[model samples]
Target: MKSQNIRLCFNNTVKALFISALLLFNTNLFAEDLEVTGNITQLGNDWLVVQGYTFYVDQNTELRGPNGSIVQFSFYQLNDLVQVKGNNRGDGTYLATRVKLEDVPNNSNEIELTGYVSAKGTNSFDINGTTFLVDANTIFRGRRGNPFSFDMIQVGMLLEVKALLQTNGDFLATRVKAEDDNHQHGNEVEVTGLIESKSTNSIIIGQWEFFVNSQTVILDRNNLLIGFSQLNVGDRVEVKAFKQLDNTFLAVRIKLEDNPQSQIEIKARIENIIGNDITV
Candidate 1:
């Protein structure tokens, strides 16, 4: 009987040790540092959300700007690109130790785009072949400031978006405002061709001359935002403009085309396919 008690005590001690080790392992796992890079979606007195993850900030947290200069948390704005180093709290949130602001590339642009939704995804939407990513801080509104949600958006719906281009070539939308489909702008014109000539304020495509202004959004062949000064003569482009009361076409958006033809639809029966070649 004494030997039985000793065996029981030994088993109990082993069980306790196993449980202790497991708890330690889990603690270390949760203590691991995590790094996240994305645009700041939401900001609060002591917390910020990035890419749908909430991170708590405290006095110990270090905040730095793009130039590596110390900065205050208040300097950050919604949709500002950032990199965060933190520890997961095991409750779906994080405790940030470092928050650094990232600079927008020179090729990037802050643009206001108005168009029909061409595609939709869980966290993003496409307009005119350009993808716009959305996060918690992206404000959505209907006519007259009525509340709207991302789920309420649909393909073919007209929306006006204000967005910033990220270094990774994604457009992070800051605001999405729905517009009426029937609403039309007067004297809207769209032209596609090589740039015949260009000046400080205008570009010639075919026979139409489109005037560019500070508000004009220029994108490169990769659909990345650029400046009007980056445009060169003989480059292929597509220009969307509106005629002003002064009988001048004001370019609203200018996109560089990747190919001579934007799209080509071929309708033919496939006869055979070999390796990397297909005969139709």
Candidate 2:
């Protein structure tokens, strides 16, 4: 009779242990959340596919674009690169919690660009792969601070542009000024490139070197003054400098591109698997 009671007790203990294991598994399953960053390859009425993962969006999902403005699901378009924060439902379906649009290079409003004009149109032009639209309010100037007409703009000329970025990635020129690239004695020079490296007093953009002294002026996208400490590698910038006799560019003013904030997501990659452990 004692052995019989022991058997019954063992059975009950086994049942309790099994239930606890099952509960733990269920908790771990629902805990899998994921984030993704990639271009939208497919779109649907209620679902979208990015980087081979299908994510479902419902009323609870929050969507935003430039300036952190709330947007609808319909605002997303094909080929738009985006960052998504979501949860994995453990059944191959992802539930989106938030979606943020990433800005395309040279596609934002705050670019103070200097580039050679590639094409000239009646009311617009192409520079550095970006289109600049002009109107009556557009101000034009020459190398000597002289007023010029729109007709003076020609292809193959270097120009400096201060423009506002449009929602659709077009640039509306507030000011268009020509650069006298042929003037060998001209001390003024402008360039736009990603910062390769920097120090407290200098920075390297592409292959060209630039120096920033105490008198140098630096501004962010909002036109607010900033310091060299605020700059970082891989930041795109436009620099207006004076060409020194030694050929090094002395930065008189600098402008950094202020990209909009986007929700960032990344996929987890498993590097190795061992008996019951995984490396990611």
C-alpha RMSD values across all candidates? 27.6, 23.8
Estimate the TM-score for candidate 2.
Answer: 0.29
After best superposition, candidate 1 residue 84: deviation in angstroms?
Answer: 42
The lDDT per prediction is 0.67, 0.64
Candidate 2 ranges beyond 4 A from true positions = 1-108, 183-280
Per-residue lDDT tens digits for candidate 2, residues 1-280, read 3454322122322222111111112122221144556678999988888656678898988898977789889999998878776654324456787887887533323435555565679999876456889999998989897878788876656687877766775768888888865331123455666677998788886456789865465777765567789988888777766555465767756778655221111112234556544332
lDDT of 1 by residue, 1-280 (tens): 3454322122222222110111112122222234556778899988998756688988988899979889998989898888787754424466787898877543225555566576689999987566899999999999777878999987656688878778796889999989864332324455677787889899986557888765466777765567888999887787766566576777767878766642222222244546544333
Among the numbered candidates, top TM-score falls to 1
lDDT of 1 at 25: 20
Which ranges in model 1 have alpha carbons more than 4 Å from their true place? 1-158, 161-184, 261-280
Cα lDDT for residue 110, model 1? 58
- Candidate 1 clash figure, as a count: 0
